[model samples]
Target: MQRIRLDAAAAANAEDAEVWRWFSGLLEERRVRWRYMFSRWVVNVDRVHVATEQNFYDAIRMAKEAATRRGLGLSTIGCSRIR
Candidate 1:
């Protein structure tokens, strides 16, 4: 995995900052660099764009956990569906 795009609707609320923080921590764990851009409509919604690698599955689990904790929607959150 060379990238991960977090779904904005997954955590669309002011109370979700903890989830964002956890997601940031996961990025650090994978040593993946990321850029975030706020999506239109809801200001609480944004994407966490990450750059990772093939062996990043270990971090994927943690990232998923963070996403889930942050109210990740059923929508795709993987790299393949990013673009």
Candidate 2:
């Protein structure tokens, strides 16, 4: 049982590391900014941004999707634009 738990933990850590790497690459490639504030994940791309519940991976994914949609000239329904 202990070994099983340890393996699970290791897997989770590996997944987290992978996510962090991807996020870092995204920052370099897209000039994106991110922060955790008010118990939420806030991601910004130029004038547009998104805030999501504190799930780190989901928040980043949503932000990326929003940025892509905006870049493609699609509506960003859940994102806000800085004025």
Candidate lDDT (C-alpha), each: 0.40, 0.67
Model 2 C-alpha lDDT versus the unseen true structure? 0.67
Candidate 2: TM-score? 0.50
For model 1 the TM-score comes to 0.27
Best by TM-score, which number?
A: 2
Per residue, candidate 1 scores C-alpha lDDT tens digits across 2-64 of 232344444454435654555565444453343233421111112542223234432343445
Q: TM-score for every candidate vs. truth? A: 0.27, 0.50
Q: Which ten residues in a row have the lowest lDDT in candidate 1?
A: 37-46
Q: For residues 12-74, write the lDDT of model 2, one tens digit per residue.
A: 999777656556665656656777889888877664675475877788767666766677223
**Cα RMSD (angstroms) for every candidate in the order listed:** 17.0, 9.2
